[model samples]
Target: MRPAVFFDRDGVLNEDDGYAFEPSKIRWIKGAPEAVRAVNQSGYLAFVVTNQSGIARGFYGEHQVHALHEWMAAQLADVGARIDEFAYCPHHPEGTVTEYRQTCSCRKPQPGMINELSKRHSVDIHRSIMIGDKQSDLEAASAAGVTGHMFRGPDLKEFVAPLLKQLPRIR
Candidate 1:
């Protein structure tokens, strides 16, 4: 099994403009692509895990979320980075859309997404790490048995460098 780096989509990969689904509203956070590239170059699988309550609230559809992710992946690819997978939760208990209103396990603060990724990718949870700007992100990481790094910084690469450096070199 190999180690992986899980990143939160909003606030970490892009500026969180409330319910940002439009392509025009997407703004990549400083050094976000470079950070993912570094992880790729280091041979670590990179993934994005996010909670898209907007889908449940009727702000956007699942297709729009996928389109945004595709755009993000293309942007990363342009910079020689790649995200192995994307896990998103479009469910919320209080959601306006009846179909999306049920509570689900894939949401953050739960390990559903991470666990599923681990199973699919054969990732070593103990060796993996998650980076995000929220406490819920850390809680999810902990529940998944992975180290969680809180990012509150000037740039994504700068904030992630030291943590990446601490990881033992994988053969």
Candidate 2:
């Protein structure tokens, strides 16, 4: 089975300012594109899992989230890197938007998103890894039976190369 690499959107991939939904607000982290390309070159499926509480907090809508992701995808594509898919949770318990005001398993610290992606892509979860900046991200990866890396990064490509070396080579 193919293994996957999951990334947390906010701190790991881009600079986050709380409710950042605007494409203009995004600031790509150093070597973000190269890190993605490294994963792509490693023959691993790359995916994004994010928590967009901004949607529930009434700061933005799903359309804005989609737009931002599309923008992110275009940026990655320009560098010959691409995300296989994206999964985000729009729910928050004290959300201002009633439609999204409920606890959900897809949120970080839960394995729902990773599990779903693994199932859909036929991933070998045991060999996969999750790169994130928060404990919640690591927790979700653990629950999903994948290893997790905490990225306190100034350069993501440098941080990712050694980790990529650990994956079992694809047949």
List lDDT for all candidates, in order: 0.92, 0.93
Backbone clashes for every candidate come to: 0, 0
User: Which window of 10 residues has the lowest lDDT sum in candidate 1?
Assistant: 152-161
Given candidate 2, what's the lDDT at residue 26?
A: 93
TM-score of each predicted structure versus truth: 0.98, 0.98
* Per-residue alpha-carbon lDDT of candidate 2 for residues 46-159, written as tens digits (9 for 90 to 100): 999999999999999999999999999999999999999989999999999999999999999999999999999999999899999999999999999999999998898999
How well does candidate 2 score on lDDT at residue 113? Answer: 96
**Global fold similarity of model 2 (TM-score):** 0.98
Report how far residue 136 has shifted in candidate 1, in Å. Answer: 0.5
lDDT of 1 by residue, 36-133 (tens): 99999888999999999999999999999999888888889999999999889999999999999987889889989999999999998888999989
Candidate 1 CA-lDDT value: 0.92
